[model samples]
Target: MKNILVLCTGNSCRSQIAHGYINHFLKGRNVAVYSAGIETHGINPGAAAIMKEDGISIDHHTSNHVDEYSHINFDYIITVCDHANENCPYIPSKNALRLHHNFYDPSKLEGTEDEKHTAFLKAREEIKAYFKDFVSEYFRG
Candidate 1:
């Protein structure tokens, strides 16, 4: 089984969304999906709420340090946030295919509650739509 890792700065929003999307859409497809952050902490509730709208739950996912999985081999290690993409240069897997799919930090949104939730929804939608397209076009049978 091939392992895929999606990364961001916090592992809370974008990367978590990515992990959920890939895991749900690609379930039983013989691939392992995971996510992490360069500096992980504080799993975001806004992200969880938005994902629930898509019928994807991320409540159990916690922020993860990139170093936690440094020793594992990955088929793909994609950085989905700009800060993480810029900072993540040395992923451990020599056989891994490195890619960048940058997404904005929805946690940085400044506005009302619904507005913040909307930001989370927008990011989640983008992650789902783009990843669904990507997997169907490239990884599906």
Candidate 2:
């Protein structure tokens, strides 16, 4: 089995969404997906709500700091936000492939409920598309 880490600044929105999609796509497969942040900002309610709309539940996922998984070796370390990519800590996984994608941060969007929902939806779709392709190209047999 291969272990994958999705990272972000808060682990509340973008990373959590990616984690959900990766797990959903890789179900019954050999990949184990985890998400963490530079600093735990708690799970974003907007993130959970948006994912639930897509039939994926991330409500039970917890916000975690990168150090929480220091003992495990990761096959891939992916940064879902620029902040995370810039400030990521030194991971000890010698052979881990590091990848970065600057996904839109819905948590930073401020406005009416509809606007926020739209932002979340946009990010969710982007994450879903990216991870779907990732799983197909890299993990699918």
The lDDT of each candidate is 0.85, 0.94
Candidate 2 residue runs with Cα over 4 Å from true position: none
Encode model 2's per-residue lDDT on 1-141: one tens digit a residue. 899999999899999999999999989988788999999999999999999999999988999999999998999999999999999999999799999999988899889999999999999999999999988888857
Q: Model 2's lDDT to the true fold?
A: 0.94
- What TM-score do all the candidates reach, one by one? 0.94, 0.98
Across 1-141, the per-residue lDDT of candidate 1 in tens digits comes to: 889999999888888988998999888888988899999866788888888888989999978898889888999888997789889858779778887888867899999988898788788888888788868865967
Among all windows of 10 consecutive residues in model 2, the one with the lowest summed lDDT is 132-141
Model 2: pairs clashing at backbone N, Cα or C within 3 Å: none
Error of 1 at 98 (Å): 1.5
Q: What is the lDDT of residue 62 in candidate 2?
A: 96
lDDT of 1 at 45: 86
Q: Which candidate tops TM-score?
A: 2
